[model samples]
Target: MRLHVDERHERVLALVRARGSLRVADLAEELGVSAVTLRRDVEALATQGRLRRVHGSVVWPGAAAGAAPDTAAAPAEVRDAEGVVAGMVVPTLDHPFGEIVEGARDALEARGGRLVLGLSGHAEGDAEQAGRLVAAGADGLLLTCDRAPGPDSGGWVPGTGVPAVLVERAAPPGSPGADLDHVRCDAAHGAATAVRHLASLGHHSVALVLREAADADHLRAGYAAAVEALELTPAPGSPYLAPARLPEAERIERTAEHLRALAEEHGVRAVLLHGDEFAVVLVPRLRALGVLVPEDLAIVVHGDQVASLADPPLTAIAPPERAVGEAAVALLLERIAEDRRGDRGPRRHVDLLPSLRVRASCGAVLRAAGRA
Candidate 1:
C-alpha cells in the first residue's frame, strides 16, 4: 500500500532519529520512493526544523555534533567546528552547481567552519533566503544567481549585512552588487581556446553554434576575438542556434540540419558548440542526416558535463567550477576577517580560465600535421 505524505514523513523522521542520520540515497531506497520525492520531503522537514541536511545526508535535528553516522569519522577539525558558519545560496544543485557546492563544503570543513545551504530558485528570492540564513546565525554568505541583480532591484547581497562573495556570477558596473567580491569562470577565454584548438588542428574555417544562455555573450565575444586574431574564414549566418519557441526535440533536429547546411555551403570543417547536452543530441541528429562527425565536420563542446559520454567522446571546454567555489569561500573568509578587524579593502573580481579536454570528436590526430 502507498503511504500517505504525513505517514511517510513520520517514518523518515523515525528512521533518522534511530540511525542518527541517513544517506539520502539509502533513505530513498528504504522508503521505496524516488529520490526526487524523498528530496522534496527532506526539504520540507528541514524547513520545519525537524531535520537538517548536510550535503548528501540528513540528520536528526536534536542530534549532537558528529552524531550523523556518515560524518562521525571526520577529522577533529571538521567534527569540532566552532568557527564561522557560512551560508551558501544557489539556484539549484544541478550540473556545475553540485561540484561548486561540494568544493565549498570541503573548504569550509577543512577550515573548521560549517556550511549551510539555501536554495533560492531564482534571483528574486535570493535576498529573502540570505536574510533567513543570516537570522539563523550565518557569519558570512556565498551566493550564486542566474543573473546579476539590477541596481534598483533591492539587491540581496547588499542587503545581507554579513560578508558575502558572489560565485560564478558578476555584478554589472555601477550596480548595487558592484562593490561585492565575486569569482567566475572566464567563459570568453574558454570559447577562444576552443576556436584556437580547432584552428591548431588545421581547421581554417570554423563555425560557432550557441544556445542562448547567460554566458552566450561571453562565449560569442571569445569566438569572435579568436576568429579575428587567426583570420579564419567565418561560417555563414548567426551563431545562435536555439529558437526559444520550438519543442526541445524539434529544436535539436533543426539545429543539426542548420549546421549541416552551413558545413556543406561554407565548407566549414569545424564547429564550436555551446552546451554539452545539446551537442550530444545534435551529433546523433547530424549523423542521421548523413553528416559524419570529425570526418565531415569536427566539433568541440563548451560544457564538459556528460560530454565525455557522447558517441566518439566529444572534446570539451571544462570550466574550473570547483576552483570557483573554493576561491569564493576563501575570498569570503578574507572579507569576514577584514570586517572583524575593522579593515576595508578594494573589491576583488576573480576570473578563472577553463581548460580544453581533447578527445575523439575533434579529430586532432588526423590533422596534427596540417596545423598552421
Candidate 2:
C-alpha cells in the first residue's frame, strides 16, 4: 500500500519543478499524455503539497508566488497540458483558409485539449507533416484538406496510426469515416441554398467558378445535384469548367474569360464562386466584363471579409467558423480518451454543414431582357 511517484509521473513532476510554475500542458506534450490526464496528476500533487495550483500553472514554495501564466511559460515550450487531445494544423501561416485554420486550433484548446500546428506548403508537404505528427505521438489530428498528394488510396492521412478528422470536406470515396463528428459549415448544403435563392429571384442560367482543390470536387457535386433537382440545364455550350491551380490574379482573369464565353455561348447570367477567394478576385473582372452586379449578372460566393468591403457586396455561403473550432476541440477530447484506454478504434470523420449569407452580389439579374 505504498504510494510512490510512478517513474513516468516523477519525470513529469520533476519537469514542472525544474520549470517553475509550469503549465500542466507543457508536461503533457513532453510525456505524450493528454492534457486532461496530466491535469489530474497536477491536482494530485497539489493535494499532496508537492506544489500549489494557481490559474494555469503549478508553483513551488517561494517560487516568486505571483508570476502570470503566460510569463511562466518559457519561449521554447509548446503544447498545453491538462488536455486529452492534441490538435495539429498544417500550413501554420496566413492565407485565405485562415478562418478554418484558426477554428480548428481554437476548437482543440476550448475542449481542454492541446493544439499543435505544423506548417506545410503544398500537397506533398502537408501529407508529410501529418505523418510526422503521428510518429511524434499525437493521439489525433484535425486537418483542413487531405494534404496527402497523389491518387487517393487506402493508406491515407487517417490510416496513419491516429484518429484524424477532416474539419470541412468529405472523406475520400470508399473511405469509412466515423459519423458526422465533424463540425463544419455544410458547403454543399449552403451552395444549394444559394442557388435556390437565385432561382427564386427569377434567374435560371447560373454558373459556379470554383478553385481546383480536392474539396472543391464536393462543392461541384453538390451544385450539380441542386441543378438537376431544379431541372436546369446548361444553356447550350455552357458546360462547367474545372481549372487547375492558378495564381490569384490569373484565377480571376481566367474566370472572367470563362464567364464571358459562357455568357455568350450559353447565356450564363449568374455566377457562384466555389471559394471565397474566388469571390474577391473575380468581382472586379465581372465588372470589367460590363456584367453589372444584379443588373446584367449576379454573383455568389463562399463568405469572406472582401464580401463586406467589395463594391455592391457579395452574397455568400458562410461557414460556422467559430463552431468548427469548438467542435474540433470536442472531437479531439473523445479521441484522446479512447487512446488513453488503449483502444485503437477505427478512424473518425465529421461532416459539418455551411450556411448561406445572402447579400447584394447575388441579387436578382434583370429577367426582362434575358427572358425575352
Candidate 3:
C-alpha cells in the first residue's frame, strides 16, 4: 500500500524536509500538482506529525521558534481531472486590453479554474508578476507580453517551469518559439487590410499616424509592404511615429495641427490613426482646425476600442482581444493537464486575424468591408 501511494506525496515530504519549511504553493508548483492534491497530502502528513502547519506556513518537525510560515492549502480539484490555477498579467484593466482579462477570466471559470490577475503597465513589470504567480503556485501562466522572445532568445521559458501561453503577442512562425502555445491577432494583416480599404477609396496621398508601441514595428512593415503591393505612394514622412502616447492635451493639439498641415501642404487625403481613442480625441481637434473628416481627410483607427462611442463612429481594425484571451486560457489549461501527467509533447501556437469594423469614420456604405 505504501509503494502504491502516489509518488508525489513522498516528494512533497522530502521537499518540506529539505527546505526546513516550504510553502504549500511552492511545493505544488515544484510537484506540478494541483492545490487540492497538496491539501490532501498536507492533511495526511499532519496526521502523522511528520510536519507541523504554522498559520498557513509549513514547519519541519522540531523547527526552532520563528520558523518560516507558508501559504494556506489551495482548494482541491472539484472533479477527477486536475484543476488549474492560472495567473494572467496584462498592461492595464482599462480599455483595449482590459476585455482580454475579462475573456480569460470567463474561460477559466467555465473550465472550473481560477485566475490570478496582475498589471505591469506594458512589459515594465512582467518578469516580477511572473515570479509572484509562480510563487503563488499557479499551475499555468497566461501572459500578455509587449514582445515575445524569439527562438534564439530562449522563448519565454519561465524559470518556474510553469507552462506559458501568450495572449496578444507575436513570435516568429515555425521557430522553436512555436513550441510555446500562443494566441494573437495578425497585426500586419490588420494594417494592410485597412490600407487597402483606404486605397480602394481613391485616396492616393495616404499617411499613417501611429503612437510608438511594441507593435509599431509590425505595423510599419505591413504599411510599407501594402503601399508597394498596391502601387500607392506614401506621402513624404508618411508614417508619423511618435515615441509615446500623446500624454498632455497640448501634445495632442500639436499633433493635430501638424497633421492638418501635412494634409493641406502635402495633399495627404487619408490617415490611419494608431487606435480609436486617439481618433476620438483628434477628430474634434481636426474639426477645430476646419478639417472635415471623410470630406477633407478620411480617417481609420487601428483598434476598435470604444470606436462606436466616438461622435462620428470610427472605422477600426478590431484586435481579437477577447478571442485571443479565451483561446490562451484554453491552451494553457490543456498544457497544464498534459504537464501534470508528464506528457511533454509538441507545442501549439495560434494567430488570429483582425476584422475591420467600418462606420461613419471611414465613410463606408455598409458596416464592414464585405457588405454588399
Candidate 4:
C-alpha cells in the first residue's frame, strides 16, 4: 500500500471506509508518512466521529468496536477510483527496497488513492500477508515476488478480485508470458553495461560476485550475453558464493580468498559485485590480501545502497528502483480504475534501464587499460 500527509488523508478515509478500520503502523507505512503525522490525521477523523481510535487500530463508524472483519463496515460505500485503497507488500524497508515502497506511496498519493503496506520478509510468507491485506480491504495490490509461487498461490498478489502489479518479476509461467501489469529493471542491459564498462577499461575477463539466494538468473544471463558479445571468458561455475544471510568477518575473508583464486585461475581482472554493503566488506578484505582495488583488481557494485559513502566510493549500476515502485503503483492504479470502468484492455509490462555509476573503484580499471 502507498503517501504525502495532505496527499494521503483522503485515501486514508477511503481505506477506512473499505476496510472498516486500520492500524497506525500499516497506515504510516502505506502513506509514506511518519506515525506521528498519520496519528494526527486519525485523531481528526476520530473527533469528527467518522473514525474511532481503538488501541493500535482505527474503526470506522459502521464497524464494530476495534474490529476489521468484512462485515464490520456494512455501510461503507465503494467509492470511485479517486479514493481507492490499495495494498502493497514488499520484502524489506532497508536500502533499495525502501525506495520502492516510498515511491509507491508518493505515486498513490498523487492519484488520491491510499495504500496499506505489509512486509513479507521471505517467500514462504508472501502468500499469507497478501491474503491478509486483501481481507483487510485492499481494492488493488502491488507486490514484489522474490521466488516462484507455491502450488496454492494463484495469480498476482493471489487474491480473487484485486488487480495487481508485480515489481521486478516477470510473468507467463516463465515463457515471456506477461500476464499481468509489471515493472522491472532491465537486468540484461545493466549487466551488459557493467561488462562493457570493464572491457572498455581493458579488463578482458571480469567476474560477478553475488549471494546464491539472490534472484540472479537474469543477471547471469545478461553477463553471459555480454561476455559473448565481447568475446571474453566469464568466471567459471557462477560466482554466487556469498551466503544468503549477512556475511560474518571470517566468511568475508574466505570469500575474498575464493575471489583471489578465481582471479588467478580465470584471469579475472575486474569484478562486479552485489550491493555497497558487500563492496564495503570485500574492499577491506581485499586490501588485507594485498590486492589494491582497480590497481590490482577493478571493482564495481550493483545497487546504490551507500555506494557513494564507501571508502573508495564504489561505482554502481544505479537502477531506478524507486521509479520501478512508482511505476508499479501507477500501473496498479490504472488497472483498478479501468476495472471500475469496465475496460479490460491489454495489460502493460514495463522495464526501466539502469546506468553505470563510475567512481574511483572502477574508473581506475579504465585508466589502467588506458581508455580514460
Candidate 5:
C-alpha cells in the first residue's frame, strides 16, 4: 500500500532526525518513492519548518552545527584546493528570477560549488558587477540583462577571460556577446500556447494586455502568430493598455477600463495578461465595473507567481524559470572545465519551452478532464 502524505512526511523527518542529514536521492530510494515525489514531500516539510533543504540533501533544522556530512562538499581529492565559485547577476530577486536564482544555487551546491550573487539595474552595470564578483574569486559567471543585448550595448564581450553563460537573456546576431552561451525560456511559444488554450475553450476572440518590459516583445510576437494562425479576431486598440509612467492605482484603473471595453464593445471574452501582479488587481476592478470573472470575461496570466492566490485562481503560462537557471549553471560549468583542459567548443543557445497551469480564471470546464 502507498504511504499517506502525512505518513511519508513524518517518515522523512524521522529518518533525517535519526541520521542528521541525507541526500534526497538516498532518502527517496529508502522510502520506495520517486525522487520527484520525495522532493515534493521534502518541500512541504521544509515549508512547515520541520526540516531544512541544502544542496541536494535535507537536514534537521536545529542540527546545522553538528549534522551529518554535507554530501555536496568537495571530495577528498580536491578538498585541499579552492572550491569552485560562480557569480550570478540579476536585475531583481522578485517573482520568476527569485526562483531562478534558488535553482542555480541548489545546482551549484550539489556540485560542491558556491554561488556569489550581484544585483544590477541595467545592462551597462552588468560588466562592473561581473568584474567585482571575479575579483572576489568567482570561477565562472552567470549574467542576466533587462533586455536583449545589441551590437552597441557593450555589455558582455567574449574575451572577458572568465567562463560565463547568459540566463534568461540572449544577444542578437553580430552582437559582442553573440558567441556567449545562453539558456532562456521560449517566451513566444509560451504566449502562443496561451492563445491556443483560449481558442480551444471556444473563445473566438482574445485580447492581450501587457506591461512594457524586455519579454513584452517576445510575448507580442507569439500572440500575433497564434492569432494569425488560428484566424481569430483580436480586440481593438493596442495591447499596451497602461503606460508605465502612470501611478500604480491609476494604471490598474486604466487597464481595468480597457479590458471592460474589450469585453463590452469588442465581444472579447478571453484575455491573456502578462505578469501576475496586474491580473490579480485587475480582477477586483473589473468586478466593481459589473464584469464577473469567468462569466463576462476569462483571464490567463503569463507569469505564475501569486496567480494561484487570486480569488478565482488564474490559469497561467509558466516559464521554466528554475530549469533555465539549472541549465545555465550546467553550461557554465562545462565551459569552465573545457577552458582548464585547453579545449574550445562551438557556442550553444538553449531555449526551454513553457507549460500552461490550468485553473479557475480561464473558465476551463475541462479541469476534471486532466486539462488542469
Candidate 6:
C-alpha cells in the first residue's frame, strides 16, 4: 500500500499536536469518537511513524517542544455525514428533545441525508403521526420516546419496513417483535450524580420532580438505586411513578407548590427535577413562594438547556444530546445498508454516558459553607 494515513489517524495526530498532550478520555470527548476508536487510530498513526503514542498523549515526531502544533483537516465523510435525510419524523421537539432533534437533523444533513420531521401534540396522537411519517417514505425514523405516556405506547415503530431508531430512551420492555435500534443517554448515571451532588451539599432530603408516569421499569429501578447509593431515603410516602396526566401551566404551578409543601413536611433541603418543563416552571414559582434557590432550598434540574438558563440559571445534569443524535444516525445508517444487503443487522442498544455542567441557579458552594 502507498504510504498514507486515514482521516482518523490524522485527527488523533492533530489533536495531540494542538493540546501538547491529551489523555485518551479527553481526546475521545473532544473528537466525538469512542476511546476504542481513538486508540486504534493512535496505534495506526504511531505505526506510520507520524506520531509517538505515550500513555495517553501523542507527540510530534522529532519535535523538541510539544506546543504550537499544526492543524489537520477532519475527514470529509466524518464532517459531512453529520445531518439526516429530509422528512424524518422527530416526535416531541420540545426543550431537551427538541435540541436533540435539531442536532440530529444537522448531523444527517452533514452526511447528505434529509430529515422529515413530525410532531405529536399528545401521547394519544403519537401513533398516528408515526404512521403518517412512515407512509410518507421517511428513510428512517428518529423518535424521542422517553416522555411517552406509557411503556406500552404503540405506533413508535410502524410496519413501514424501514429502520427505526429510538433516540434518548431504551426499548420498552416485553412488547416488541420489531427490530428497533436504541440509542439513549445514561440517565441512571445522571440521576445518581444529581443525588450525590445534593448529598455533598449537605442536603439530607430531596425530591425528584418527574413529568409522566414511567412505563419503563428500568427508570424506576435506576431511581431506587440512586437513592440507595446516595445513602438517602426516598421521600417518605412519595409516589415512585410519574404524573398520569399531561401538565398544564397552572397544574405545573400547583405541582411546585405541592412539592414545596412536601419538602417542608419531609425536611427536604433540595429538589432535583427530572422533567425539564417542571424545572422551568418551578424556578420562578419557587422564588415567588420565597424559597430562595440554593439558599433556603437547592435545585438540580436534569436534562439540558431549558434548565441550564431558567431564570436565575439552574445547576443541571446535561446528557451528551448531540452525541446521542450522532450515534443514533450512525446506527440507522448501518441498519439501512444492511437492509440493502438483504441482511438484517444484529439487535443492539447504544447507551451514551452523561456529564454534569454546573451553573449558577443551584447553590453557591460558598453559601452552603457559610451556613455550615
Choose the strongest candidate by TM-score: 5
Q: TM-scores across all candidates?
A: 0.76, 0.65, 0.70, 0.72, 0.81, 0.66
Give the TM-score ranking, best first: 5, 1, 4, 3, 6, 2
lDDT of 6 by residue, 43-86 (tens): 87779787766434555676433221121243233333323353
Off by over 4 Å in 3: 1-82, 121-124, 146-156, 171-179, 243-247, 366-372
RMSD of each candidate relative to the true structure: 10.4, 13.7, 15.6, 10.4, 6.0, 10.3
Question: Global CA lDDT of candidate 1, please?
Answer: 0.83
lDDT of 5 by residue, 305-327 (tens): 88999988999999989879978
Candidate lDDT scores, in order, read 0.83, 0.62, 0.73, 0.72, 0.83, 0.64
lDDT of 3 by residue, 250-300 (tens): 667877887889788888878888878878988998999988786678888
Per-residue lDDT tens digits for candidate 1, residues 215-284, read 8888999999999999988778757568758899989988888888887877887999989988998898
Which model, 1 or 6, shows the larger lDDT?
A: 1
* Span of 10 residues, lowest total lDDT, candidate 4: 71-80
Candidate 5 TM-score, C-alpha based: 0.81
Clash tally, candidates in order: 0, 17, 3, 7, 0, 25
Give the true-structure RMSD of model 2: 13.7
Give the better candidate number (1 or 4) by TM-score: 1
User: Which model, 3 or 4, shows the larger lDDT?
Assistant: 3
Residue pairs clashing, model 1: none
* TM-score attained by model 6: 0.66
Candidate 4, residue 183: CA error in Å? 1.1
What does the lDDT read for residue 58 in candidate 1? Answer: 83
Better of 1 and 4 by lDDT: 1
Q: Which stretches of candidate 5 lie over 4 Å from their true place?
A: 1-54, 58-82, 122-124, 366-372
Clashing pairs in 3: 36-76, 56-70, 57-70
The residue pairs in collision within model 5 are none
